[model samples]
Target: MSASAGSPGGAARSLRSLRDLYDQAVELPAEERERFVAALESAGSSHCAQLRRLLAAADPSAESPLDDDPWARVEEEEGPEPVPERIGPYRILSE
Candidate 1:
C-alpha cells in the first residue's frame, strides 16, 4: 500500500502526538515527569492499553521468551491500526 492508502484512527493519531510530547517533556524534571505521565495516561484512555503493551514489548527489561510472539499478542489485542506498508525495513505485522 502507498503512504496515503490508509488513514490512522483518532487513537493512533493521539498516541503519535503524545509520543512527541513525551519526547519533549523528558527535559522537565521532578514532579513534571509525574504530571506528564499522568496526563498522557489520562488522555489516551482508548489507546493507552495497547500503547503500554507495545512499550513493554519494546523494553529490554521486560523481554522474555514466550510460546506466542509478542507481535502476535499485540495483533490479537489491537486487531489493527494504520501503519505504512513499509517503515524502512520493518512492516507492522497484521492478521
Candidate 2:
C-alpha cells in the first residue's frame, strides 16, 4: 500500500520528488521554464507552488560556487605556506 502524506516515509519521498523536480526545472532554458511549471500546475501537481517559488528565487546570472577556486582566497589572504626544512625526526629534502 502507498504511504500517506502524514507518514515519515511519505514525507521523505515527497521531499525527494520535489528536489528532483526542482533540479529538472532549473536545467531548462529560462524561456521554457514557465511552460514547464505551467504544465505541472495544469496537471494539478502538488509541487507546483514550491517549484515556482524555487524557480523565482534562482538567479541564472549568479556565478556557481563550484566555478571559483576556494583556495585562491586563502592564498591571497595568508600567502603561500613555506616548505618545512625538517619534520620531527626526518629532514624534508624535496618539495
Candidate 3:
C-alpha cells in the first residue's frame, strides 16, 4: 500500500524512525533526507519525537540556517546593525 494510505495507529510514528525510513528514502540526498526527518520529529509530542531531537543533535545550524543567511547578505549590502535576538531557541547575539 501507499505510505500515506497505510498509516495506521502508530504507523506514522514507526515509519519516522531513521532506522526504518532511511532505507526507503535512500534516493534522497543526505541533506534532504535529514531535513525530512527533522520535520517529522518536530511533528511533536507524538510517538516520533526522536527524529526531531536527532536532527538538532546532528546539526544545530541546520535548524535555521536561512535566518543567518539573510542577515549576512543584508550586512554585505547595507552595513551592520544590531542583530535580532532569539528566533525560538536561536539567538542573534551580535551584529
Candidate 4:
C-alpha cells in the first residue's frame, strides 16, 4: 500500500517518529547513502517494509510511486498531466 493509497498500517504509522532522523541521514552525500543504509541495516534495522519505505522516501528515484492505475486517485497530487513517457535512456516526456 502507498501513502497515496491511504495506507496507515501500523508499520507505516509507527515510523513517523523516526522520520526526522531519516530525513537527516538521507541528506548524506549520495555516495554515502549505501554505507548509511548498510549501517542502519546492520544495526538491527530488520523490518524490511519499514526500511524500504525510509529508503524510498529518502530517494524518490529509487522506485516508482505508482506502477499501476495511473488514473487511480492521483489527480490531486500531480494535476491532470497525462501519464509520462520514457524518452531515450533517462528522461520522461510529460504534458
Best by TM-score: 2
Q: What is the TM-score (0 to 1) of candidate 4? A: 0.38
What's the lDDT of the predicted structure labeled candidate 3? 0.57
Model 2 residue 35 CA deviation in Å: 0.4
**Model 3: per-residue Cα lDDT over 1-95, one tens digit each:** 45552567346556555545544444566578666665656775342455445544555456665556777788899887655687788977665
Best by lDDT: 2
lDDT order, best first, reads: 2, 4, 1, 3
The TM-score values for the models, in the order shown, are 0.32, 0.59, 0.26, 0.38
The digit string of per-residue lDDT tens for model 4 on 1-95 reads 45532456655655664665467567787777667767867877654346556766667566565655767568767778765476568567545
Question: What C-alpha lDDT does candidate 2 achieve relative to the native structure?
Answer: 0.89
Clashing pairs in 2: none
- Local distance difference test scores for all models: 0.60, 0.89, 0.57, 0.63
Task: Give a tens-digit lDDT track for model 1, residues 47-87.
Answer: 44554455445555554786458798898898887767777
lDDT by residue (tens digit), candidate 2, 8-63: 88999999989999999899999888899899889888999999888887956656
